[model samples]
Target: MIVWVCYSIVTLIILQFCILLIRIDFYWKNHRATSVELPFVSVLVAARNEERDLVDLLLSLENIDYPADKIEFLFADDQSSDRTAQLLGQWCEHSANRSFISIDSSQAALYNENGKANALGILAEEAKGDYYFFTDADCVVNREWIREGVGSFSGNTGLLIGITQVKAERMLGRFQEIDWWLTLGFVKVATDLHIHTTGLGNNMVISKEAYVKSGGFKSIPFCLTEDLEISRAIQKKGFGIAHQVSSGMLLKTKPEASLTSLMSQRKRWMHGMMTLPLYWKLGLGLQFGYFMGIIGLFIFMPKIGVVLALVKMALQGLFLHRFAHRAGERGSWLYLLFFDFYSSISTLLTILYYFWPSKTNWKSRIYP
Candidate 1:
């Protein structure tokens, strides 16, 4: 009975990968590559003690290829004890095209322990662009990030979610960069194929009309997974979400510095997943079954498990090989292999951490 069950699970896992591959192919064929007029865009950034990277991010924004008159950058400082506020003031005093708005600490409310969301809500009200573009304090946008994103809004795209790539400087950083690209790329591709669509908060754009129709950030003011919540809300309202594949629109983020920080970040992500609606959660389970099958093979049938593991590894290798090329990291297969193992262990720890709730400190703020 045990052997049969294990084999059945392994078969299911193989089938899931097959489905994913087919979906990617289908999307590539039917996807509409459209170009639209560059409308006025309000670039919204929420910062909380991001002194180290704020200036770099601001400098990157200055070089964007979009028209200066068509773009407005809004920086919302969530009461940073660091020089973030001073830096913003300095930039605003000198910037010819950007505008700055700081959120007073007294008015900034703690909504589900995520300060970014709180800061975003306040900035949204003051925004004047036809579209709202959300990025992070530590992210550096490509020169064409805004232009490519605005182009996606051509016909009926209500929300445009672009790609995020990690810029790694060390061994740990490279591992994280590879893991993030592989995992997120797979999810984005799968979701584009009628699976489940999720938007990363760091590189998402939404029309102001859709924002109002979906009830704005007020809809998920207290949700830790604000991006996912907003995506679902927009989907519920029947707005189309599209992904931009052009590398020009990529938002590069810094990887977590330590194992503890990585684990905490993963814990927050997994916990947020638990809060997703049932249908979305169930759909993700179909994807996760592939991982579960590998674990089952190790436990019940060593020989079959070894064979299945080899097949699984081959499939993963193919996926990573293709992904690495797209990410401009070709010849880093060996690094990706090790990173995959680290990701598996980290995912398991994240699952466990979700069951046991505890406070975590990040950037001098305590989050539960």
Candidate 2:
């Protein structure tokens, strides 16, 4: 009993220390770029059946604060069966700064399984920007999105990684928003301190030169976690990568409409983590500690574990409560307690998926 207690205490202390280290690093973000020359930026949007949101994204691009001539938008249609292609053509007919580009897999000759990467590679080859920025078609970009991202390309960074927040409209949506904020915020903070951060493909900016130097997306054409793989690849090249917390370049994505959709998404995300290298995987230690702490409490002292779990959840709520308040998300904390339970169950289900290697259905397409 004493050994278990000691182990739990040590784990909690270590996690708290790690959190503090990240907070210190974030507070003292010293890698700001001083260059004033805003390079030409190519905004790459990869879409599949995004007809519902494509128009909004294109319109948002038109409204971005960056110089229209300096910023070029490239839409890579992943052979969408919906009105996505037609809408792109309509948008291109009127928009001078943007073009609707198609992925000719027959020419680039990509395997069916590596469709997205192949499309991105073809687009990257044709992109004429000094910097390449990637975001999904379903995301609504803030007016300063491109400006803020390009501004981060200072003397030190080869890749400029930015933050993303979910647009929560419902109870489930609010839960997802809080979930992403707390979890991703901690991960980004930790990565900044430990130098093991992975980039989210949505709202990521990299110099064209660095992209070529790092071997580009072709380096991992078959990777499920292409964004993370690319970020790690950039790190392997000894270039600096930093996350911009102040710019507020939020990429708005809708939360899963159903629990089934949410589970599938979580499974896919967890399975993708398997492809990461060992050092990156070590980032999961905090998550493991949290899980073990809960389990140990329950098994060793059911009554105590129940109380501690509730207290830990309350702490998590406080963290997220602060984050939501800062991010302008209101009434999100109402479901905070429920999301805490859902997150634990989701983690367990995700672990099961990682070990099982079963087929997953996403966006009406089945992937193995």
Candidate 3:
């Protein structure tokens, strides 16, 4: 029984590895160069009580290489209590190309979408650009972000999912970085094959036409992972969606400050587990089984369990190392070795919360 279980787990891991390879190959073949005369771009940012982060992101936007005349900046102040509204007003006053949208709390309750989704829905309607780009308040985008990202879009492409690198200054930050990278790597590969779905709210670019055809954010069911929901909606409409993993396209964002915060964020994300494709669910189950198998086997047959754990770490490390190098992110090979064990604990806890959700808190809003 133990041997059979081990065999199944190993097979699943290898299958996942093969899928990653396919993603890399497909991306290279399909990646098109950035268009010279790119369409007018609208950079949309939604903020709530993010005074500090918003200021940084706004400063970064000021340095973008895209033409000021061709690009417009739209911001939504989602009923913030702090200096968010005042800061945005000041920003718009200083920048002629920038504008702000106000989100009325009373009217916001009428919408069934998530907070960010509600803000984005309004901004999308107000935007006058041909292409819509999104980034979080906490992220610092590279100067070439628009130059490189907009170039990859073709007529058929509806969505362009970019990469994000976690700002890791501590051990916990490192773990989160590895976790995000692994999740994204698998999803990017699976996404390219149309077998699995993944998206990050921190960075996304969608065509205005595609957004309208997909029924927009208001048309989709509200989920904590609105990015994934919108991506699926657009793709279902037969619009092409592509994943861009180049280093230049990577947006840098701060990791959660504490374990509790990280877990809360993960729980919110896992709350939408049902929204993922069957193949992604199966892959997650196999991962769960693999970790459980390691614990059970270790107790019953110490040697075999140890062997399995070591082998799994080595295989995982190789892929993570390669991904880190490709993305120009600094990750120690040593960190990857034990990352699976660390991640398994969080994954198990997140799965438990997925089945029995706790209070989800984000942007000062709590959902019980």
How would the candidate models be sorted by TM-score, starting from the highest? 3, 1, 2
- Model 3: residue 56 alpha-carbon error in angstroms: 1.7
Give candidate 2 regions above 4 Å deviation: 1-35, 104-112, 277-289, 295-307, 321-331, 363-365
Best by TM-score: 3
Off by over 4 Å in 1: 29-35, 110-113, 279-292, 324-331
lDDT against the true structure, each candidate: 0.74, 0.71, 0.80
TM-score of 1: 0.90
Residue 366 in candidate 1 has what lDDT?
Answer: 72
lDDT of 2 by residue, 1-368 (tens): 75386347535735564554446444645334565577788988777888987887888777888777798888888778899889898887886777867765463436325566666776787789999989888788888777677766666577877667888667777778777887666655655675666778777888887888888787764656677777777777877788765445566777888877887887777766777668656656555557666677677678777776676666666655554444445435568778867676767766776567677776566777
**Model 3's lDDT to the true fold?**
0.80
TM-score of each: 0.90, 0.87, 0.93
Give the higher-TM-score candidate: 1 or 3: 3
* lDDT, candidate 3, 147-188, per-residue tens: 777887876888888889887778889888888888877767
